[model samples]
Target: MTTSHVPAGAHPNDGHAGPRVGLFVTCLVDLFRPTVGFATVALLERAGCRVEVPRHQTCCGQPAYNSGDRKEAAAIARQVIAAFDGYDHVVVPSGSCAGMLRVHYPSLFEDDPDWGPRAQDLAGRTHELTSFLVDVTGVQAVNDQRHDATVTYHDACSGLRELRVKAQPRQLLASVAGLTLLELPDTETCCGFGGTFCVKYPEISDRMVTEKAEMVASTGADTLLAGDLGCLMNLSGKLHRLGKAVSARHVAEVLAGMTDVPPIGAADGGDRR
Candidate 1:
């Protein structure tokens, strides 16, 4: 239950000067779900953003910080700040990481007179992907492709609780032609994969994910969509473990119409969409 420090009156960039965006590719998306990263770029580019992936960017340090390793967390935080220093706005596909950059970074540097203000400035300019699209860029919908399957959304803890990302992705999803968004039971509850929490307390994580899997099953949706891959993976793993049939996907993948890619449990068929 960490407190979020989103700046007051902060909103997404409105394509002012054709905003230059630095994509903060989270460690999970970078290592495991590169497709989400690619789809994020496609969505942003389609909305007329000049997107750049800062090569030096690394993890947002949420894991280290949550594990009580402030020193290591701050070190990684500095690396991220330095990597995207010149960009007009930082856009992250993962709500957890984006929340770290926008809410926790400033607090991490609060005692440093030199870095604190800079960190605050950086935090102020960052935006979660869907929020940036609907709020800043005024993106109504994507025009490239559409899916006809019923989809249920899972609101990852960080995005829903810290970044207030509930309606943004839904708004975008609604715009997709032929896509049906279904309501999941207990949509706001955590899927219990709090980064290392899943690894540390496998029993609890398994129980939570089992509950989430049941909710997804109740929806009768063919696809489960979430903004954060951590929650998606947790739920997806549990779905596989339970021999359930629902497929999991990142919100960017759905919004970008990359449904041609098989669902999470499917065999390694290459990206067809």
Candidate 2:
């Protein structure tokens, strides 16, 4: 993908004025769920942030790093670290990527004298999307159209276990007008889409997602929501494959009221819900 550069002054800091944020659009959201990216921009802008989508940014090296490919992982990690080096903070929509940036990057460079500290510094400033929205930006709610639908959220593994991104997205979702947040059974269980793990172990992935789908189905919610696209995609794919009627959406998409987009596998002219 060709990198798009945002000139230094492209995003003017008007809200907190702490640090201009380099919005890290993860590969999944970039390719499959562009609406999530747009919603993220809307939420951050609503929260008074100077958001910039740095074109040079790419994968967070989680897949490579998790597979024990340190050399390639470090190379990509270095590129990501350098791309957003001067930004005040790196805001990412996915918990997995945010955790990788905030947790793994520093470890990747721990032994290096120069890049190690740089990675640590970058890690220190990284914030998951909802965390930045509710905590850093102090945003209480979004002013989107009211949708009276019961929604349940799935906590992605890296974000929940590694980054502790549990309540932030829920809090933000609860604040959305006319939306009722429903509780899911065993909400914290892994959805089995651990990057390449699903591909490498298809059977296990299928079983995990099937169980997750069952939990989501039991909620009687019209919509199933989650922060990370990986979990959403996995659960949604299985749900679609099974011909279940529940619709799946990203938290940002719900909060931003961009529900006009069709659910997974629907035809272009088909109904969204």
Each candidate: what lDDT?
Answer: 0.84, 0.82
The 10 consecutive residues of candidate 2 with the worst lDDT sum are: 1-10
Q: Give candidate 2's total backbone clashes.
A: 1
Q: What is the lDDT of residue 89 in candidate 2?
A: 79
Candidate 1 lDDT, 1-273, residue by residue in tens: 000121212222244536798999899989888889988887777676778899997689998999999999999999998898988889999899999999999999999998798899899989999998887878766664577878899998888888999999998888777889999988889998999999999999888889989989889988899999889888888887898888889989888766676766566783222
Error of 2 at 140 (Å): 1.8
Give me the runs in candidate 2 sitting further than 4 Å from their true place.
1-19
Looking at model 1, the pairs that clash are: none
Q: Candidate 2, residues 1-273: lDDT per residue as tens digits?
A: 000121211233363564477989999999898989988886666565677899998799888898999999999999999988888778998999999999999999989999999999999889999887777777666654466788888989888888888888887677667788889988878989988999999999899999999989889887888899988888888888888778888888877667788865556677475
